[model samples]
Target: MILIEDTVISDDVADKFFVCNLEKCKGACCVEGDLGAPLEASELPVLDEIFPKIKPYLTPEGIKAIEEKGCYEQDWEGDYVTPTIEGRECAYALYDERGVLKCGIEQAYNDGVVDFKKPISCHLYPIRITKYEHYHALNYDRWHICSPACDLGKNLGVPVYKFLKDPLIRAFGDDWYKQLEREIEEK
Candidate 1:
């Protein structure tokens, strides 16, 4: 799948350091964009095998994304929403903990689809690291209800080097990442 290139992008991963005060914001993250984070081409087969039986039950966009293995099939600048699961109008159409719409994939996993797991990007939140100049930097992109888990500074006090590298390895793999590692490290 082709990654929708974002030239102007967030420097750090948005990790939820604390369980976001989501109730206050009411699951704003779910409405923000595609709920699932980036997935590797290698991971396509897993969903292909599972989505068919459940395809009709999924939202039209969700089904299309599964087929393409591309999350943002269209440019989701904003203004998108899903039909209420039980009864409510959430853009992403996920359940609310009392009120706020939660991630659709997470809720789907709870309903069933036991094999469902978070994408590598989702697992590593607010602590996102990307190649910036000669070095890597940690960024707190969405501090609000978007990614409350991103503020790891409290426990870790800071996002250490390994935190950045491990996820990069998972996202890009050993060889591709090694190139990036060399680019940043050796210079």
Candidate 2:
């Protein structure tokens, strides 16, 4: 583990390679999970505030789920998460013309309908964070559905940290990411 600031980062985050192969995986991570995308407490109000703007990008099913279940729901562990469509795909997920699942919130953000670009947890996927009282544990999440991504990342010579630079910066700030990069380089 590497410690920087208040985060304990897994070695796999630096050693393992992963870049999302969306065409191959078809965004299975958003669908195969038992619950919806994990959300931070601060994001709850953002979802509520932006629902109106992102609604147009969402599918009817997703809209129904969100309307029925509210903007977010509590998981079995009592963590806040986006509601899912009948406990399947995230309610904020929509299938594109190619049948690949996409994030509706991100779509809206791309179109300038909203400023927030989806949940931080969703943005920093393959890197799940567990917040404790003193620190946050950042770990690489290995899933069968992401085999293509792993293979591609290996071929492209991209480690998990590099592949997720933008989100890491978004989550922990640029200085923290620079510190992480320096630590990885010294190793």
Candidate 3:
């Protein structure tokens, strides 16, 4: 493990390779999960604030799910998460013209309709953060659906930390990410 500040990052984060191949997986990460995307406590109010802006980018089913279930809900574990469509796909997910599921909130952000991007959890995908009382543990999430991403990353010679630079920086600041890079290099 590599430690920086209050976070402990798994070695897999530096050793593993990944880059999302959306064409191959078709965003199955958003649909195949047992629950919707995890949400931070601070994000609940943001969801409520941005739901209206993102609604137009969502499908009727997604909109209905969000409207009925509220923008976010508590999972079985009582952790906050985006609501799913009939407990299937995430309620914020919509299909692009090519049939790949994408985040409506992200589309809205892309269009300058909302200031907030999608949830930090969704942004930092394949890296799930577990919060403990004292610190946060970051681990690489290996899912079968991400095989294409693994293959592509291997072909492209990009490590998980390199591939997820932007999101990592977004999650833990540029200075922290730099420290992680330096630590991995020293390893």
Expressed as tens digits, the lDDT of each residue in 55-147 for candidate 3 is: 899999999998899999998889999999988999999999999999999999998999998999999989999999999999999999999
Q: Which candidate is the best by lDDT?
A: 2
Candidate 2 clashing pairs?
none
Residue pairs with colliding backbones in model 3 are none
Model 3 backbone overlap count = 0
TM-score of each: 0.44, 0.99, 0.98
| Ranking of models by lDDT | 2, 3, 1
What's each prediction's clash count? 21, 0, 0
Candidate 2 residue 183 Cα shift, in angstroms, is 0.1
> Residue-wise lDDT of candidate 2 within 1-187, one digit each (tens)?
8999999999999999999999999999999978898999999999999999999999999999999999999988899999999889999999999999999999999999999999999999999998999999999999999999999999999999999999999999999999999999999
Off by over 4 Å in 1: 1-17, 33-36, 53-93, 131-138, 145-187
lDDT of each: 0.43, 0.96, 0.94
The segments of candidate 2 whose C-alpha lies over 4 angstroms from its true place after superposition are: none
Question: Candidate 1: worst 10 consecutive residues by lDDT?
Answer: 1-10
1-187: candidate 1 lDDT, tens digit per residue: 1121221223233222343445565755545443334444454455445555444445655454444533232225342123232222322234444865555555556678645544444545544545446554444455455443334443554332244556656555677545544443443
